[model samples]
Target: MGILTDTTHLHITTWVVAVILFLVAAFMQRDSKGRKIVHMVLRLFYVLIIITGLALFIEWSSSDPMTYGIKFLLGLLTIGMMEMVLIRSKKQKPVTMFWALFVLFLLATMFIGFMLPVGLDFF
Candidate 1:
């Protein structure tokens, strides 16, 4: 419990980094080698984000399972939307819808995360 006692910073850091990487990868030329590298790095951040998020959830969710559960699901949906947007963009398909959903879900997830007991309480 010691190491995992407070994973909030790690979780938030992962999300921030993942978002930046995703944006960078998404805007790069589809066939560029640098885009491929950034995409791979973004994938790694995805894994790190999931791991840190799960750690925080497991550590603090007992206090309010329902809200935490919703936040968790929203987080997953946000991640899925991000990946879908990137994939569709790379395939030269229309990504406007996925981009919209990604923004929606990401904002919702952030709101919930901030409202949680262990969260920033900014909202």
Candidate 2:
């Protein structure tokens, strides 16, 4: 588990890249092939984020399962909201609610992650 000895950094990096990709895809023309390619890449990053997040959760759950569990769920919801917004937008549907939820969940997940024991000591 040497490579996964520190999944925190890997998880953060994946999510950050995912967010950037999401933004890029969101702003692109819905009918463009480039947007579709970026969306696919973003989905790959989503898998990476989930894997690294689960690794960290498994390693840190014993200390405070409740908080870690909450963060885990929030992270998943954030990802779901991101996907929903993109899909809806591509379908020419209104996604104002999904966009708001995506931002809210992302912020909450990040705040909790930074406050966790294994996370950065920013707070």
Candidate 3:
């Protein structure tokens, strides 16, 4: 497989891209054309994040199933929060809670990813 298809590479890259797109979508003006485009792109990023995350989880779950399990659930929660924020923003509703949860889950996911024995020097 080429470098792009590598699970670890894809996982990290997608996470970063997803976060960036999430922020853009979150901050865009309500009901604006730009916001719509950004939100659509953000949805694609979410899909990439899930796919790459699950690939990594399956690879690492054997040795540390407990950690991976928690991370997996957190990942899902993070994605859900992302979607919630978008919906709330589109409706012009307050997204404070959803934003908080999104940040929390995103950070937790990164913390776990960083601590894993991936042997990468990203830090």
Which segments of model 3 are wrong by more than 4 Å? 1-7, 119-123
Q: What digit string (tens of lDDT, one per residue) describes model 3 on residues 1-123?
A: 334334477778887887888888888788889988988888888888887777777766788888888887998899899999999888879999999999999889778777776526567
TM-scores of all candidate predictions against the true structure = 0.95, 0.97, 0.87
Clashes of each: 0, 0, 0
Candidate 1: Cα lDDT at 114: 94
Task: Say which prediction, candidate 2 or candidate 3, comes out ahead on lDDT.
Answer: 2
User: What is each predicted model's overall lDDT from 0 to 1?
Assistant: 0.88, 0.93, 0.81
Instruction: State the lDDT of candidate 2 residue by residue for 57-100, as single tens digits.
Output: 98888999999999999999999999999999999999999999
Tens-digit per-residue lDDT, 1-123, candidate 1: 445446477788889999999999889999899988988898898888887788888888999998989999999999999899888888899999999999999999999999998899686
Number of the top TM-score candidate: 2
Query: Whose TM-score is higher: candidate 1's or candidate 3's?
Result: 1
- Backbone collision tally, model 1: 0
